[model samples]
Target: MKLRFPTATIAAVTFFASLAAGMTSPVLAEETASPTIVTNLRATPMVPANAPVRFAPPAEVVQTLSVVPAELTAADDSVTDSTTDFSTLDAAVAAQSAAIDDEELNCLAVSIYFESKGEPLAGQLAVADVILNRTTSGRFPSSVCSVVKQPGQFSFVKGGRLPDIDTSRRAWKTAVAVARVATKDLWQSPAKNALYFHARHVSPNWGKARVASVGNHIFYR
Candidate 1:
């Protein structure tokens, strides 16, 4: 004989079977859930090898710049010292005729006579000419004292022996004015390159070696 089970009992059995199959299935477990990963993103600074970097403190930059000007100034002073020569009033008169005056001419003559009397006329004029040559040479000082005081230049100045001039004297004033005129090149044909000069009576080695002769003096180029 055949027996029939209750409908409610059959339905409950079917539901339990389905639940057990789902729990044991690998495909169902993978499809149901997954773990999520989170990542953090932040900004970073990059430095270049050759790029100019700024200093943290601005005062340091200013200090570096300040030292540069002093260095440049020192270099310029060195150049000036090397190139410039100090000339005398006599040299100025020889170089620039316009700067010379009667007073300066007389003073130069007197100075020459005091120093060297053998060639009074030529020596005086020649000394004056030398002073003029130094004026425009650019190697010498632009002013009178500067040129006269040039180191190791003139014998008279070797031991720091400078002529004492009474500035208040009429002769001194005249000499100064003449020196100015001679330095300015006011008069021409006074002397040329007369670096070395001597009297007409005495034939020094320089006398024969001169490029030109003017008045009682022989001059060299």
Candidate 2:
């Protein structure tokens, strides 16, 4: 057998139960009724309303930058003395010119001996300079030996062989020394770019621009 409560009593009991739950758990009401708190996480700075506004293009600025001042000194005083010798410049330049070296040196020495054994050191260097210029011109073989032996170039070459150079001869020694000086470029050549030269006696009248005359040879470019 089942027993049932009266409808009026049930209604009253349900109403009282809800009231008791509210009293027991007031935190649920507070949580439901409270306003949601919004937080600002970004450190975004606020510009003051009275401050001057500045606009830097997006492409120009990635970060703040600062510059520091550099230390400076007074300009050096100009030279007032006039006693400096200017010709000494030329002398100094002449003193600085020296020789270049190896198989190249041997070839250069041979050319100097045959072409200018009697000529002074300057003349021998001038000869070597001409040969050097020829090599660089693209018209002749780039190597010193090939340039010397190029067809019909030098008169002393017979069947591609230079007459044996005698080391004992003073002229040969001078020629070797000059060749070394010329090869190393230890001394600057006054011949400059003269690619052709002939004995002083023979005026090839090649009508070429004559640049320098060293010893018995006249040089032309």
Candidate 3:
């Protein structure tokens, strides 16, 4: 079989095929026509995910740590560095005597001097304790002088007055110290809780519970 076409139609088909071959793609033409731009930037290194980070404390925060109040330091020192000693009864008596010049202290010393001067130191202090205990007890006057000078109590009291004493004697000094010791509760006497006492030479038949016996005197509660 033979195929035949007109000469004009053949010419038109040949012109369209030549035009399609001469055209370029739109995206390729744009890329080729644009100018190349170059920048002077450097690449930064990335930190590892497992790395540890450290930040320094601020200067003001470091300075504030050493600033403690002076009162707080002083309170701590007082508790740690105290030097007062109370090792023995005589030591305690010596310590307390420097502060014992009041009227009550004088009355207590005078009573101890006349009543128990011949007795041992412990016995003399016991006498002072009994007087002080009487002052606290509901049965007697509240004041130390009143308790010592009460009617019919001590043999040395004449007309509610204390007798003259030779203050120059060592016995009087010791009596004063013993009185101070008892008043300040610096020493515990063997005649604790005793409200009454008498010479052992005479038996009053007090029928009261006996508390202690020191030197020549016996004490009762």
Candidate lDDT (C-alpha), each: 0.52, 0.73, 0.84
lDDT of 2 by residue, 67-179 (tens): 33343243332221122222432332243323333677778788988998876667778998899888888878998899898779998888888778677776776666676
lDDT of 3 at 209: 96
lDDT against true structure, model 3: 0.84
lDDT of 3 by residue, 22-139 (tens): 6646667777766442122224456899999989889998889878878777756334323444677677666554334688998999999999997888899999999999998999
lDDT of 1 at 186: 39
Pitting candidate 1 against candidate 2, the one with the higher lDDT is 2
Clashes of each: 38, 14, 0
Q: Pick by TM-score: which candidate is best?
A: 3
Candidate 3 weakest lDDT stretch, 10 residues: 35-44
TM-score, candidate 1, is 0.36
In model 3, what is the error at residue 92, expressed in angstroms? 2.2
Lowest lDDT block of 10, candidate 2 = 77-86
